[model samples]
Target: MLCKIPDIAKGVISLFASGRLSTEDYREIMQPQIESYRKSTGKTYIYVEADVLLEGWQHQSLAGSGQVQLPNFDALVLVGGPDWFGNAVRLMGPFMQGEVAWYPLEQKALAIQWIAARTDSCN
Candidate 1:
């Protein structure tokens, strides 16, 4: 399932998802949150906490808006997913305009704090 983490500060968008994920989850759910945050802050810190990232049909949706709008984010904190998820994220490094890092799910608080601190430094 895909849903937003509540009460995060403005410019900070955190999503918690696990189990199965689909292209629609990104296109429908995650994309809107990114767009909304971009419109408000012009810069963002995105935190994604997922167990097993992509499942059947989910990989296809990973293609985001190419290089366009890449500068929307300042930092990206990803937590708890399979090794493939980490690799995939690193592969997107050249395309994404944010600093990316990963951590175990148990260190979610640390990941969040890192993004918060990095977001402040980037400003």
Candidate 2:
């Protein structure tokens, strides 16, 4: 499951994730943000805090379904699980089209700082 975090700055969004990921999670919760950015000619800054990876076939589909709006992103900061989760992020980077980064679950401040730095480079 996924949900958008409210009250953050424009062009930047925070999302919390738990349980198995799915295409529906993106379609329902994330696609709207991409559409909104496209209409406004703004780059997307997506920060996701995930509690778990997508399970079963959902994990495989992420490689395909995940990149539908590939160019819509400018920076992606993901915070979750172990330090190796960052490795998982890099492993999955080819399936994405932005700066894909991961931070330990407790280093949210660092994650936010990294995303803020990339905001200046957004197109």
Q: Number of the top candidate by TM-score?
A: 2
Candidate 1 structure quality by residue, lDDT tens digits, 3-116:
777734446788887767665666677788888877876777888787764342344444573422324577887888877777777787667766888777788788878888
Model 1, backbone clash pairs (residues 3+ apart or across chains), number: 0
List RMSD in Å for every model shown.
3.6, 3.4
Give the C-alpha lDDT of model 1. 0.71
Full-model lDDT, candidate 2: 0.70
Model 2: lDDT of residue 38: 58
What lDDT does candidate 1 reach at residue 98?
A: 65
**TM-scores for every predicted model:** 0.72, 0.74
Error of 1 at 40 (Å): 1.1
lDDT of 2 by residue, 34-103 (tens): 6776578557788877764533225554575454333547778888754556787889887887777888
**Candidate 1 ranges beyond 4 A from true positions:** 7-10, 52-72, 90-95
TM-score result, candidate 2:
0.74
